[model samples]
Target chain A: MRSHQTVVDSRLRRRRTAETVFRFFLLASVILVSLILSIIVVSILWKSLPALKLSMIFKTPGTGYYLGKRGGILNAIVGSIEISFGATLIALMIALPIVIYLNTYLKKKSFLSEIIRLFLDVLWGIPSIVYGVFGFLLMLMCHLRASLLAGMLTIALVELPILSRAMDETIRLVPNELKEASYSLGATRWQTARHVVLRQALPGLITSTLIALGRGLGDGASVLFTAGYTDRITTSLLQPVATLPLAIFFQLNSPFPEVQQRAFASAAILTLLILFISLLTRFLGRKLSRHRIK
Target chain B: MDKGRVLKKEKGRLVAAGLISFFPIFLTIAIFLLLLIKAFPLLSLKSLPDLIFSSAWQPQKGQFGLWPFILGTIWVTATAFILAAPLSILTALYISDYASVRLKKWLAPVLDLLAGLPSVIYGMWGTLLIVPLVGKFLAPLFGTYSSGYSILTAGIVLAVMILPTIVNVSVEVLSAVPAELKEAALSLGATRFEVVRYVVLKKSLSGVAAACVLGLSRAFGETIAVLMVVGNVPVAPVSLFSPAYPLPALLANNYGEMLSIPGYESALNLAAIILLLIVIIFSLVARLYLARLSRRRDR
Candidate 1:
C-alpha cells in the first residue's frame, strides 16, 4: 500500500510539472507574437518621426522626391483617398445587394447560399497580385491606359468579397423573430429587407465599408500594374495617379537614407489611417450596439 | 387593395435583387474565363505540361518555364507553415484553455489590431528590419554571402503576417468546444492538460485544420511583403539563405517589362492563373471543413 501511494504521488508530480512547463511555453509564444507586432509599429514610428516634415504632409511629390529632395506624399495621399473611396462605393453597390439577397431570398441552410459563400471565400483568398494581373488584362481588352479608374476598378474587385462577407455575417445575425414580425405585418420580402433589416444592419454596413476602404487604401500589389504612378496630383479618373503604398514602395527601394526615412513616414501615415478607421469601427460599433435589439 | 399591382411590384423587386446577387457568380465565371483566354497563348505554346515542367524562364527565347517560381513559392510557403503552425496552435491552446478572463480580453484586441494591419506596413517592416538582421546575423551562420534578402527572411515575415489568421480561427474553434465536455473530462480525474489535449483538441480538429489551411492560403497568396524581401531571384531555393522568387513576386516584378515582350504577357497570365486556382482550391477546402464544423455544432 505504501509503495503504490508513493508511485501515484510521483506520477502526479511529473504531470503537474509537465502542465506548468507546457502552459508557460504556450504563453511565451503568444507574447512573442504580440511583441513582434509592437516592435514593428514602434520601429516604423521611430524611423518616420525624424523625416516627417509639416510640409511633407501637404505638398505634392516633387521631381526629386526619390533623390532625397524636399517633397511630400500628398499626391500619393490624395490618390489613395480618391481610389479607395471610389472602390468602396463600387463595392458597396454590389455587396449590399448580394448580402440582402443572401438573407432575404435564401433560407438559412440552403445549398445555394452555401455555394455562394464558397465562391466569396475563394475570391477573398485570391492574391491581390492576381487581381492586378486581371486588371491589366482588362485594361488590354479595353485598350485603356493605366489610370486612376483602373485602380478604382481593381480595388473594387479586391474589396468586394471582404465587404460582402462582413455584411452577410452581420445580416445573418438579425433575430428571426424580427423578420417574422415584419412578415406578420404583411410586409413583402423587399420591404422587410429595405426598412427593418437595413435599419438594423446600418452600423455593420458602414463598418464593413470602412474596413474595405482601408484595405483598398493600403494594398500596393493590386494597383501596381493598373495605376501608373504620377508625381503631380490629378483628379481626372483617366490620368495616372500615385498612391501611398506605391510611394512607400518606390521610396524604400531608393538607396538614399533620407528617401528611406520618407518611405517610413508614408508608411506611418498609412498605418495611422488604418488605425483610425479601426478605432472608428470600435467606437461606432459600441455606440450603435445599444440600439440593437437583443 | 390592388393585390395584383402589389404582387407585380414584389416580383419586380425580387427579379432585380436576384439579378444583382447573380453578379458575384457572374464575376467568378468571368474571371476564370478571362484568365484562360489571356493564358491561352501559353497553354497552346506547346503543351501545358512542358511549360510548367521546364526549369528556365527566359521570355525572350520563348522558353517560359515556371518550375523555379513554383518551387520557390512552395519552399517559402512550406517554411512559413513549419515556423508558424506550432507557435499558433500553442497560442490558441493557451488562449482558449488556460488564460484568465482578463488576459483573454487583453489578447483579443491585440490580435484584432494585428489582423487589421496592412500588408504594406508588414513589407516595410520586413525590408527595414528582418532583411538587415538576416544579413548581419543569420546568413553568416549558414556560410552564405549575406545579401539579407532570401527565402528565410520572407518566410519569417510571412509567418508573422499570417499569425493572426491562424490564432484567431483556432481560438474560435477551441472556444466552441463544449464546456460540458471539459467538465466531464475533469470529473473523470483527467489533468487539465490532458482534458485539453484529448477532448478539446479532438473536438476541434477539423476547425483547426481549416485555420491552418486558411493561413497557408494567405501566406501563399501574399505578394508585396514577400516581394519586398524575397530577393526576386528567379531560381529555385536550395537553402533557406538562398534568394528565391515566388510566383506573386515574379508577377509583380516582371509584369510591366514583360508586357513589352511577345508571349511574356501570356506567361505571366499563366502564372496568375495558377496562383488563382491554387488559392481558390485551398480556400474551398478550408470552407468545406469549416462548414462541416458548423453543421456538427448545429447537430
Candidate 2:
C-alpha cells in the first residue's frame, strides 16, 4: 500500500514539474524570438534614424555620383505602395470570387477543387526568384510585358494561394446552420453566400487580404526581377518601376554605406507595415469574438 | 414568381465571377506556360538518367547533368529535417500532451511569432550572425579556409526556418488523434514514452509525414537565406564546409547577367523548369495526403 501510494505521488510530482519545464521551454523560445524581432527593428531604426527627416522621406535618391546624398526614398516608397496595392487588388478580385464559387456552385466539384488546391500549394512552395525568371520570359514574349502590371501579376500569383486558402478556411468556419437557414428561407445559393455567409466572413476575408498585402510587401527576389528598379517617377504603368523590397535588395548590394542606411530604413518601414497589418487582424479578430461572447 | 429572372441574373453573375477567378489563376499559369515553352527548346536532352545521375551540371557547355545541385538540395534539406524534426516534434508533444492548458495557451503564440517572421530577415540574420559564427568555430571541422558560408551553415539556418512549420502542423495532427486513444494507452499501464512512440505517433504518422515533407519543401524553396550562406560555389561539394549552389540560388545569382549571354538565359530557365517539376510532385503528394486526412477526419 505504501509503495503504491509513493509511486502515485512521485508520478504526480513528475507530471507537475514536467509541465512547468515544457511551458518554460516554449516561453523561452517565444521570448527569444520576440526579443530578436525587437532587436532587428531597433537596429534598423537606429541606423536609419538620421535619414528619416521629412525631406529625406519626400525627395528621391540622386542619380549622378551623389547617390548617397539622397533626399528620400520617395519613388521607391510610392512605387512599393502602388505595386503592392495593385497586386493585392488584382489578386483579391480574382481569388475572392473563386473562393466564393468553390463554396457555392463548386461545392460538389471536390475533385477539381482538390487539384486546384494542390497546384496552389505548388505555386506557394516555389521560391520568389523563379517568379523573376518567369517575369523576364513574360516581358520577352509579347504585349503583357514588364512594368508595374508584370510585378503586380507576379506578386498576385505568389499571394493567390495564401489568400485563397485563407479564404477557404475562413469560409468553411462559417457555421453550416447559418447556410441552412438562408437556404430554407428561399434564398438562392448566391444570395445566401453573398448576404449572410460573406457578411459574416468579411472580417476573415479582410484579414486574409491584409496578410497577403503584407507578404507582397516583404517578398523581394521576385519583385526585383519583375519590376526592374528605377530612381525616377515613371508614370507609364508599362515601364519598369521600383518597390521598397527591390530598393532594399539593391541598397544592400550597393558598396556605399549611405545606400545601406537607406536599405535599413526601407526595411524598418516595411517591417512596421507588416506588423501593423498583423496587429489589425488580431485586434479585429479579438473584438469580433468578444462581441459574440457578449 | 419572378424566379426565372433571378435565376438568369445569378447564372450570368456566377459565370462572370468564375471567369474573373479563372483569369488571375490563368495569369499565374500563363507565366508558368511562358516559362515552360521558353525552356522546352533546351530540355530535349541526352538521357534522363544522365541528366539526373551524372555528377556535373555545366549546362552552359550543353551538359545537362544535375546530380550535384539535386544532391545538395536533398542533403541540406535532409540535414535541416534531421535537426528540426526531432526538436519540433518533441516540442509539439510536450505542448499538446504534457503541458497544462494555461501553459499551452501562453506558448502557442510565441511559437507562431517565430514562424511568422519573413524569410529575408532570416537571410539577413544568417549572413550577419551565423556566417561569422561558423567561420569562428566550424571552418576547421571540414578543412575550409575559415569561410563561414557552407552546407552546414545552410542546414542550421534552414532548421530554424522549418521549426514552426513542423511544430504547428504536428500539434494539430497530434491533438486530433482521439482522446480515447491516449486514454486507452494509459489505461494499459503504458509509460509516457511508450504511449507517445506507439499510440500517438502511429496514429499521427501520416500527418506527421506531411508536416515533414512540407518542411522539406519549405527548406528546398528557400532562396535568399541559402544564397547568403551556401557560398554559391558551382563546384561539387566535397564536405559540409564546401560551398554549394541549389538551383534557386544559381538562377537568382546568375540570371540577370546571364540574360546577356545567348543560351545562358535558356539554361537558367531549364533549371527553373526543373525546380517547378519538383514542386509540383511534392505538392500533389502532400495534397493527396491532406485530402485523405480530411476524409478520415470526416469519418
Candidate 3:
C-alpha cells in the first residue's frame, strides 16, 4: 500500500510539474509577442522623434536627404499608396471571378480543382524576388524601365494567391444547401451563388482582401526592384514612383543620421498601418468565428 | 462516390464546366510563364555548379556562386528552428493535452495575432530592440562590435516570428491524436509526461518535423526584418557579431542596379529564378504532406 501510494503521488507530482512548465511557456509567448510589437512601435517613434520636423516632410534630399534640407519622403509616400492601391484594385478584379468559379463551378475535388489548388500553392510559395525580376525583365523587353505600372503588376502577382485562397475559402463556406435551395427556386447557378453564397461570405472575403493589402504594403523586396525608387511624385500611372517601405529602406542605409531618422518615421507609419489592419481584421474575425461555428 | 455517380448524369457540361471552372488558373500560369521567360538566360547546364556550390557572388568577375547566401540562409534558419521548435512543440503539447478551455480561448488568439504580425514590423522592432540589446550586451563579450546586426539577432527575431506557426501546426496535429491511445497509455500506468513524450510526440513527430521545415523555409526566405537587422555583408563569418548577407537580401539590394548590364542582368535573373524554385519545392512538399494528413484524419 505504501509503495503504491508513493507511485501515485510521484505521478501526480510529475503532472503538476508539467502543468507549471506549460504555464510558464504560455506566459513567455505572450510576453515575447507583446514585447516584439512594443519594440517596433517604440523604436520607430524614438527614431522618428528628431526627424519629424516640417522641413523633413516637405523637401527633397540634397547633399544627403537626411543631412541637407531637401530630404522629404512625399514622393515615396504618394508612390507607395498609388502602387499599393493600384495593385489591390487590379488583383481583386482578377481574383473575384476566379474564387466564384472555383466554389460555384468546381464544387467537388475533381482533377481540375486539385490541379488549380496545387498551382495556387506553388504560386504562393514563389519568391517575391522572382516576381520582381520577371516583371523587370518582361518590361525591359517592351522598352519599359522599372515603372509604377510594372511595380503594381509585380505586387499584384504576389497578392493574388493570398486573395484567391481567402476568397475561395470564404466562398466555400457558403453552404451548398443554400445554393441548392436557391436553385430549386428556378435561379441559375450564378444567380444562386450571387444572392446566397456571396452574402454569407462577405466578411471573410473582405478579411482576405485586407490581408492582401497588408502583404502588398509590407513588401519591400519586390517593390525595390520594380518601382526603382524616385523622389519625385508623378501623376502618370506608368511613371517611376517610390513607396514608403522602400523609402524607409533607402533612408536606413543612408549615412546621414537625419535620413535614418526619417526612415524611422516611415517605419513607424508602416508598422501602425499594418497593425491597424491586422487588429481590424481580427475584430472582423469574430464574424469568421461565427462562420466556423456553423 | 454516390454523389459523383449521381452527378455524372450531367457529365458532359458538368465536367467541361468543371474543367473551365478554374479559368483563373491562368493567373498562376501567367506568373510562371512570365518568370521562366525572363529568367531563362540564367539556366545554363554549364554554370550549374558555379551557381549552386560556388561561395563567391561577384557577377563582375563572372563568379555566380550562391553558396554564401544559401549557407547564411540555412544557418540562420537552423538557428531559429533550434530556438523556436522545442518551445513551440511543448506549447502545442500543453495546449492539446492539458490546457483548459478558458486558457485556450485567451491564448489561441494571441498566438494567431503573433502569426498575423507583419515581418516589417518585426524588422522595425529588431532594429531598435534586438540590435541595441545584442550590441550592448552580447557583442563586447564576443570581442566584436554589435554593429546592430548579426546572425544571432536575426535568428532570434525570426524564431519569434515563426513560433506561432510552429505552435499552430503542432497543436493541430496533437489535437488529432486519438483519445483511445491516451487512455491506453494511462491504463498501462504511463505518467502524463511519459505518455506525451513516448506516445504523443512519437506519433506526431512527422507532423512536427513538417511544421519545423515549413517554418525553416519561411525563415530562409524571410526579407525586410532580416535585412534590417543583419549586417548585410556578403562574405562568410564565424562570429555572430559579424554582418552577413543571404540571397533574398542580396537579390533585393542588387537587382535594381544590376539591371543596367546585360549578361550580368541575366545572371541576376537566374538567381531570382533559383529563389523561386526553392520556395515552390518547399511549399509543394509541405502542402502534399499536410493534405495527406488531413485526408487520413477524415478517414
- The lDDT leader among the candidates is 1
Model 2, B1-299: lDDT tens per residue?
Answer: 49999999889988987676565456557767877677665556455566667776564566656667777777677777898877777777777777789977767655655565566666666766678878877786646565888888888888888888888888888899898988898898766665677898899988988877777777877777677788887666777777788888877777756634444556677678777777666755766786689788978
lDDT per residue (tens digit) for residues A214-290 in model 3: 88887777776677777677588678878887777777778877667777777766766777887788788675657
* DockQ metric for all predictions: 0.76, 0.37, 0.34
Clashing pairs in 2: A56-A71, A56-A72
Q: What lDDT would each prediction earn against the true structure?
A: 0.88, 0.73, 0.74
* Regions more than 4 Å wrong, model 1: B1-6
Worst 10 residues of 3 chain A by lDDT: A60-69
lDDT by residue for model 3 over B1-299, one digit each (tens)? 35565445444544554554454466557656766565567655336766778777677666677777777776677778898888777777778887789978877766755676567667767876788888898888767776768888888888988888788888888888899999999899776776887888888888888877677667767787788888788777576666678778777777767745545666665666666667667777877787788778888
Residue B95 of model 1: what lDDT?
93
**After superposition, which runs of candidate 2 have C-alpha atoms over 4 Å from their true positions?**
A1-56, A63-67, A143-145, A233-236, A289-294, B20-33, B45-65, B100-108, B141-144, B184-195
- The model with the greatest DockQ is 1
Q: Which is superior by lDDT, 1 or 2?
A: 1
What TM-score should be assigned to candidate 1?
0.97
lDDT (C-alpha) at residue B69 in model 2: 78
DockQ result, candidate 1: 0.76
User: Best TM-score goes to which candidate?
Assistant: 1
Candidate 3 clashes between residue pairs 3 or more apart in a chain or in different chains = A60-A70, A60-A71, A61-A70, A61-A71, A66-A259
